[model samples]
Target: MTRIRREVLTLPAAELGPDNPLPALRPLDEVHRIDGRERTDLPADMARQLGHEPLRSLLPARVRDGYGRTRAPRALDALVIENDRLRATVLPGLGGRIVSLVHLPTGRELLYRNPVFQPADFALNGAWYSGGIEWNIGATGHTTLSCEPLHAARVPAPDGGEMLRLWEWERLRDLPFQVDLWLPEGSGFLYAGVRIRNPHERPAPVYWWSNIAVPEDRRVLVPAEEAWHFGYERRLSRVPVPSYDGIDRTYPLNSRYAADYFYEVPDGRRRWIAALDADGHGLVQTSTDVLRGRKLFVWGSGPGGRRWQQWLTAPGTGGYCEIQAGLARTQLEHVPLPAQSEVSWLEAYGPLDTPSTGEWTDVVGAAEQRLAAALPRARVDEAYAAWKPYADTEPGTALAAGSGWGALEVLRTGLELPGTPFPESTLGAAQEPWRQLLRTGVLPEPRPGRPPGPTPVSPPWRDLLETAPATAHTEYHLGVAQWHAGDRAQAVRSWERALRRAPEPWPPLRCLAVADQEAGHHERAAERYADAFRDLCRDGHDDDGTRTAAVAALGRETLEALLRVRRTAQARSVWERLPAAVRLRGRFRLLLAELLLAEGRRAEARAVFDAGFEVADLREGAEDVGRLWNRLTDEPLPARYDFRMRPDTG
Candidate 1:
């Protein structure tokens, strides 16, 4: 592939001229100025102060004319410093690496860039061809297009020396480009366009789109025939997708009148366009002719989060519409593209008087007519009707029901306890007894068998449990209630039953482990905890590894509890069976060393403590580990030292 180069320049436009038709263009300058202000000169004092810190010393200093000076710090040093500061302060602690710069204020950041091509292998090559494009306010109200070669920028050490190259293009026509506009903070209007000419002697096969992402809750109104395609995986599929892998297939779109729509255009078309609802909201349209067809895509951001860029619905979320100009899915095998042929043209007409619809055969014509028409009055009748149910309800019932789950029916049909053989009245009587367990620190006698006599006539719990064996959630809830009611044995049984029927592993594992721990089954509790940790680890839970370490720590605690009862031999045997990963953990190793010392094995204890100190030092990488080693080796404690400081504390 040939390398593609981008030309960067400021847009030349004065303030809106008297003859300009679009009055909304006047605010472009203000929006540009606002965005540019985010890139103001960095404070030199702050940079120097940060440079003195150990962890933050990696931040680079600002360099003036860095490229021409041979020994100067790279331009990327300033960028990295700025980004690191933003990550440590402005953004949540989650760090994001900067990738490409489109403009000073706007660019393609790896973590928070516009959802064009995701940062996949295909995107790496595609992004290089696309270049860094930005649209900002010009001297006039008109927008300017700024472009920069992504590879030209220099990065600092570590990441800087890596050989990252942009995709090469022989001619500019081989590249497809679009202008991205960052919207202002408040409600306003923005427009985007692409001017492409087929410089090739023969028409080039083309597939182009203006992908707009919106929030999940925002409703879209599009014209359709009998049914429209609904994207299952947000923007990829038109039907219900079984998994993320099956997102490529398109299904017939079917949605309420409020659902967004994607219009599929047949191949071999030249020009296509669409408009957005006129309330001065954003809109997007696309035209493509790769498979001898044209496709148009559109959607809106549902109600939530700040709206940033065009088609951006929320801060970190959005949906898309794909307008295709090609043969239908059925006719793909029969269609063939002419060599070196032009594909299609896409145009977006925003700030329309009404919502965009498929009913119009000529969208541009309809858009022009709508633009001439007066803006319609805002209506609240439908909204009022939707909210009428809450107003008409009785105050008592309304107050009692908090939300969807707090409805009267849900309250009346309370949770069911599993493995409990008791009447509703007997269960109710046990509530106070359960509460007494926590206060008095006493365990109730286990029931030998099922309770005597017939089951209670008003046993709502038995009916609910028997009828819905799969109600593991209810079983767990009831177990917690029983634990609080002073029936420790019954709580254990209930949690066991819940684990047997629970669909997922997490809830049941947690309930069972807690029940065993409370029931004085230390070894059994450790086993259950380990099982839960392993299961969660296999399922990609974030805290799985941490939880596994915690389980090992708990096992050590359990051993200490056993030793308190003079079961030293049993504790030693249990400790020997622990997993290697757990045994090497800082807390577990410390406990093991202490346990060896308690057994009067001084030399063995010394060895264990030495190993533990090394592990702790490696894991924590702090001076405290060295101090701990000295203390364990019989060095006198420091006079002012506080032994109670936490291991994790700096």
Candidate 2:
């Protein structure tokens, strides 16, 4: 019999600090986009879906960029589901990620269990940690819930065993989804049944990827001859698998930089991917045909890639690569789920015991044969069929609770999702103001001196705000909704109205600054940002970590805006006002160096770099450090600071 129990796993972790108290009015800035030239070779259907229902803004979800590099040992709650052959440890609060998977027979760990809980800027709403198996949903980027919680409970499995079910309402698409994990008695493979339901009356664009992290020093095999390679250069080109550009790409270390290879799995082939060690022992992940895609992402053997690996966890810890399965042929596309429909599939993860050292084809074939004997493809489909009825089973024994947004949606729309219940008991302070609006038709104001709570910009919330009395709180939230809907002019008007009666000017001023920047009013944007930063500092008591974090986060944007408009003196003043601890952060230190360079203090800027620091959340394709280093002096870029994701062609 499979057993489920709660436990704790201790690790050195950086705190995921308070969320940025601002609405994410625009999509995250990125230079790596699919341009027209890159789209020429894409299939018609794939190209069409790539352009369909793309992300515009991550609203209602605030940016979570307040995390820092400091870490201390902490105990995290975990739920372990195990039988005799394998033990799976899951973190319910961290997107219900499978943090550890150990095959009891060989005592071999099958997944890359990251040694630390270090939050980085990888998710859509920020604060993402690397490792184990993460369920990516919403859009092309990592899910917004990467650091957020998921409701977990015990539910009956198809084989009369207890399954651990993790469910949550994905706010981006307003869809409820669930993942059920179970292990059959005496079976080595762990089964995951995943479902995403479109409860709305209209079709909703959905994206999902089950990302599995495994040790990188292994040969990865996929059932395909060709793959679509997407690299940091922002182009997708089809190339032969196993060997690309004279190097065998299946061995992750053969590459020189980070990249993704989406295998072109033929229609009739089994959907699976595997990573095996030198002894042909590792993990293999497979799913039913509905999950159609398999991908391999590697941070290759380069200074930047190696630095990223060490930056994600502790030094001396082994590096890892990702083997992912998704709903589309490639992650850049989103499939439309029709109204009132759901997509469900079963995925299995377990130990592979096939010969790893041989010709590529022979290795994959042997693994496939071993897979057939251990858990057949037909068995996966059969498990899917059996799990469908159980997918609707009312959850029992609540193990963990997630955000209250889902419960608020249930209360507002009376949604009838059966297995994934968003009961009133889950609603809390975050949902309180919205609850008031739903009941009394008036959005309540925040307590004095504190920042306003999260603003919901969906159509329903927007409509409610439109009808409510136009106070500063209502108008500010209404402006956020307007901006999310792409009504820039109306949004500005609503914000201006909010400014007229606002208690503090920072909130509306910050939104207006974003508006000005988008309109190319750089000077005006800088002015507004400066004003907002000053006002935020004035209002903050600096007694609580949340307020201090807010001040530091807003200060970065203000300084950047000032520098963009060449307001060096003002930027210097802004830097001086920041707390000493905030100024010492690597990001702020880099900004200080930039400020010094702008002021023609090249020696000081160079000294800052010589002192050494690491920007913990340096973006994937960012070349800012290299660019600054070149500007300061024509010296070789430091290995620790080299984070270039591609070869330098310049």
Whose TM-score is greatest here? 2
On the 0 to 100 scale, the lDDT of residue 120 in model 1 is 9
Cα misplacement distance, residue 169 of candidate 1 (Å): 45
Q: In lDDT terms, which candidate is top?
A: 2
lDDT of each: 0.29, 0.90
Residue-level lDDT of model 2, residues 82-152, one tens digit each, is 99999999999999999999999889999999999999877887789999999998988889999999999
After superposition on all C-alphas, the RMSD of every candidate to the true structure, in Å, is: 29.3, 1.3
For each candidate in turn, the TM-score is 0.24, 0.98
